[model samples]
Target: MARALPQPRRASLRRLYDPQSGEELDQALVLWFPGPASATGEDLAELHLHGGRAVVAAIETALGNVKGLRPATAGEFTQRALMNGRIDLTQAEGLGELLSAETEAARRAAVHASEGGIRKKVEQWNDRLLNVSASVEAELDHSDEEDVAAVIGSGLSYRRDCIALAEELERALASPSVERLNEGIRIVLAGPPNSGKSSLINAMTGRDVAIVSAIAGTTRDRIEMAVTRRGYSYILTDTAGLATKTDDPIEAIGIERARQALDAADAILWLGDENPDIASDASIILIHARCDEPERDATPDDRTPVSSKTGAGLSVLWEKIEELASRHIPAESAVFFNERQRRLITEWKNRLEAAAQEEDLLLVGEQLRLARSLCDQITGRAGVEAMLGDIFARFCIGK
Candidate 1:
């Protein structure tokens, strides 16, 4: 412990001693910040001690005997920051994401959020909403005093503003969700039996995740592997071959699961010679696999011919995959919302849209207020008690 508190916000090297026994302790650098201006909007101190268990334990022991001194619990510092208005809920969530980010894209997106990208957007939306709300309130206040024609004209303008704000929210919602970004784009390999689907997956991932074999139905279940390719994340799935018919019960189950995977895929790598028959919104890439083998049929003009065994055409396939993936990946600088944030914003947008459509000024006003409340929850201004614990629990101690 320091003999005296260091100059505010300045790290000072100091000698340490045990107050109870007057024994010399390790030298350390300490910095102090007075209340209301620090990270938590309260007095704060940092001790940069030598990184050793004994050193930390000694400091903890000395501090433990002091009145009202204890270690922070999980996310306590950040929770306090939120409670004290040092940072909003979105930033806290972003910090959590930053801690767990695995890929470069995830890290960049998390950095944007942690730096108040989403909060600033919410603030702008809130300002616009308040402007529209003010108009609605004014109309309500002067309904009898104002000319009927003038009231109608101004009301139209206010509703237009509401619609514009709703459209903005709609565009934000249309962007790929943060969960999808974190979980990676779902790329499912679907084709007939012995069509080199397994080999293609192993080639794409640069590892043998799925069992490749000449026998049909070797992959009896879905084999999911998350991989990062060229700074983008992808969840590559090698599914059981979609055979025309099956008598075995387990293989049948796997075939059914393969069909399900097709439905959920963001991109399909179809290794079969024929065109895919499944009805899906996912991008389908026709592939002519085993191109290096003798007596192989002519490669179709529309299909991407590839040889997983020799690594031929893998670069072109990767380029095509990356091209499709780029459409789903949001720009690093762009602001995107997580599931909770998106849900709140969606409700807020719905309220705004309803307000724009409603003919009754009173109803419009109510909708505007509800929308504002949702914005509040987005920034942790109100009505977030139930989710606070869940959010904070994501962070470890000393966050």
Candidate 2:
């Protein structure tokens, strides 16, 4: 490796000429990073090579011939980073999330976690837990005034802190904003046939993603388009019109699918002049679509009037949906965006809650140790060797 460098210890451009075959593979700028400062806390180098496949293949083949040289598997570099304390488990996973992020909201959350924000919070919790554990362990060892006071004091503080943390965990588990960033918030367009559901969806996305037809039951299935509104991803679905007593098998199937879509939606845009009195717990924007060409008994206060063709009241309906989504998530939350993180954190929180109720100092100390172990698992301080391959497999090669 030293002989291949253009200079002894400094980064510089170098040309790769095969020693045995006398063939020049490529020229590249290379930087040799010494141990303890690199991403993996070991000696590493960055070879900024040209992306030509032949050049890359030749280099790889040449290196493969060396006794100790080998190719990196997917996310192997990141796993090395985790193993060497260069980055914790959350930050390592965050790197994967950042690479896969599909929306601005998702990117924001991923970047935050990747940059050690979650690690900082976890460190604070570990410090507090350690203090409580020490206090409990002391109480277990002896029965004295000082030990009793320490136990009582630590228990009170731990109770207050654990309750706060539990509340935060519960809120994070329930919030839709963070989870929807990946799955995408589903907003179903539902109403009678020829009620302009397709046209409204097209207008919302500013693209003709759904077929706009005047014929009833023309759209026989859910036509979903990924719509980005204010940087949040939404699956805007235009479904078959809902009505009773459909003799056509296909139309009936479409209606059943539409009902299924509505059932799964985060919000419903009930578009029509007639209110069908459907039972739903979801937030709905009752939109009297096609108001520009309308005949009805009276426009209800609960339902907004809009026309996709004329672009009337559409902005107001959009505002309503945006507001609903924004209100669902907090401005700043210590939320775990993925299920794996949520599950581990929830386990830790549950242990803390259980430990809070135990009166015996030895039992309480054991529970706290178990709770700390869960946090250790969350940060990959313990018990993660088996899953390392699975975790890093999602990453790109050489990362």
Candidate 3:
């Protein structure tokens, strides 16, 4: 049997918390509001609580005891806010992100989003789409009196605007790189054995994280650590060195994993002791490691010279990392992040392309509707109960 918890209490008007503990207790109470003066045009009850484990648990117990009050799901409060016209969909998503943000860049991005950056754009597109839908409906209704060409021309103009908006949405979704910005940037270090990869990791993180040894193949696995550089979070992965011949099976596996890391990384620090003959790969920033070595002359035009021993060029390396991190910032217009958003945006793009190529009014209307729905999905304006639940379920119970 599940344990019963207390119901959450309502705070008093003009004051939120009692002076007993200088903390608000989570308990059930009711206060009256004579409304032509309410914020939402309705009498509102404010809930205040002590942000403590026991207090929240007690509140939940109290709420469970009550008949009407249920625990708010992920975005439920925001959903209610939206329904009450307190905020739009974009602002809701932004608030969600803001609550989860761990870095300065992410916080800024979330704030920008919550301020209706995406909402305004989405609303503009929706307005254009609504116009197109109206024109199509008018054509369908007044086909008897209206000239077919004139109606078609009007519909075409609106369709063109819809198509343009779709294209703009697609570009915004792709350009912002929102997922990477929301989550920390992924950066991996790769090089041949004994090229100071572990040392570099330690240097960049300002900690002696990995086992630093002169022995080749010292690091036999992908060692990952979180680092904050210039107030931005980054997942820096130090992978095993890439080498062809290794006697140990473990070392061989580590090498394979290193290759996979390189393939999967957002940016790769291709380290080398001396200038090794290696082709430049996309998304790779070549780094000449062990600059302290007297004999080694590894220096490429694009490669930054770094010495983990004396901490030389580390500042420059951080600058490089920051530069790469900036590329993934989520812009105001971009709302896409997960697979759902991607699929919807792709569908929208496909429909827009189809509408541009085809002259069928019905087909165009259908595509526009699909595009609008997809845009709605981006802001959780459309049916998103399941998604909202999933997103909120991932949060802590009291969040």
Candidate 4:
């Protein structure tokens, strides 16, 4: 009897060689996973073959003959990982975000989430909530024997702490800036003619993305470009100059479009040569254009002087933009960003705040429970299989 060589360990790609030839021939790559360390906590196997119709057909034929082997369905591997406690639902979402992230900020956010930032926060909140619930239960159980005042006082203190935690959560969840940062902030450039709106756009993006001209109303349509500053992506829009008494239909249409852009923008860079004043309902940042020229008599609140031609004060403008973005958006601690998370968090916050205001202990307990359940949904601990499927289905199959 001839001794057999030990089988090579399987991997993402493997090679099978002809036994007799000892020369280069057909190959089959194998993938194998042992239990516990595997994503599914079970044995797994895969086969890869050389690129050729005949080779693939041979491998498939061999695999079909094997018992208990089947093609993996989309998300089956990730779903198994979830079921086996290898990863949580938030991690799954993070994976999707990681795949789709087009900017550095978005990628960082996804990496933070995948590293358990969101899950850790949710767990902390849940732990606090559980403690509060236990204390409430204790008070309710011993209501008769203890001094009623003492029991009530202790319950009140616990309620206050719980209410404070809920308020903090609400603030975090209410942050729209974090979502905007991840999704790309919309910054609209608006000013009167010859205010350097186009120049500023070019300077910020480090490219001639817009047409710059000495004449007024050169830009009659809205132009958008993606600008990355400090690892954040901003969808910067340079709209036609906003001015009065334009009879041209195209100019009128451009003005209307500018107004619409301002309304939808997260921030406005209002350029001005004389006064730095531009009226708008949007959050405005006053920028004194033509800073290369000598300082003229002008008084504008929080005005930043910028010279796009020489790059003067551009750094300050970028910093100001970052500051405004941070102020409007949530930090990394925010638990809600998308519509689903926002709706759930808002509903829970409303109920919890109402209970905190009420004197009824039973109602307070119920409200706290509801709030915990909502947090549970964020962490996927509340049995959200259907929602998980929908969320993961949006991702590519490999993830």
lDDT of 2 at 48: 80
RMSD of 3: 6.5
Could you give candidate 4's per-residue lDDT for residues 1-399 as a string of tens digits? Answer: 213432434443335543334333355556666777776777765556578987766555555556876656657777777778888877767766777776666677677777777788778877877877766666677767668547666564665867777797787676652355566788999888778899999999999999999999999999999876666678999999888779889999998898889878889998855453445555778887877776733535568888888998889889989887666543343343555656766776676677678677887788878878888887777768778678767766645
Where is model 4 poorest over a 10-residue stretch in terms of lDDT?
1-10
- Candidate 1 has its poorest 10 consecutive residues by lDDT at 148-157
TM-scores for the candidates: 0.95, 0.87, 0.76, 0.79
Q: Candidate 4 at residue 90, lDDT?
A: 75
Please write out the lDDT profile of model 1 over residues 1-399, one tens digit for every residue. Answer: 436799999999987778788777789999999989999999999889999999989988988888998888889899999999999999999999888887777888888999999999999999999988887887788767658547655565777899899999999999877766778989999999989999988988888898978889899999999988777899999999999999989999999999999999999999887788899999998999999988665788999989999998999998998888888885454887899999999999999989989999899999999999999999999988899899888899979
**Pairs with backbone N, CA or C atoms under 3 Å apart (clashes), candidate 1:** none
**Candidate 2, run of 10 with poorest lDDT:** 1-10
Kindly list the per-residue Cα lDDT of model 3 for residues 191-255, writing each as its tens digit.
Answer: 89987899999988889889999899999999999987665788889989888688899999998
Give the higher-TM-score candidate: 1 or 3: 1
Clashes of 1: 0
Candidate 2 segments whose C-alpha is farther than 4 A from its true place? 1-10, 146-161, 176-179, 244-252, 274-276, 294-302, 329-335
Which tens-of-lDDT digit does each residue in 1-399 have in candidate 2?
236544434779878766557678788888887778888888888778899898888888877877888889899888888999999998998898888888777788778889987677777778878877776666666556775766566565556666676676576567653455766777899998888899999888889888887788989999999877776677889999997779999999999999999888888998866675667766788998777775742567888878788898888998898876665543344544566667877887888788778777677778888988977887888898887888799999968
Evaluated with TM-score, which candidate comes out highest? 1
Better of 1 and 2 by TM-score: 1
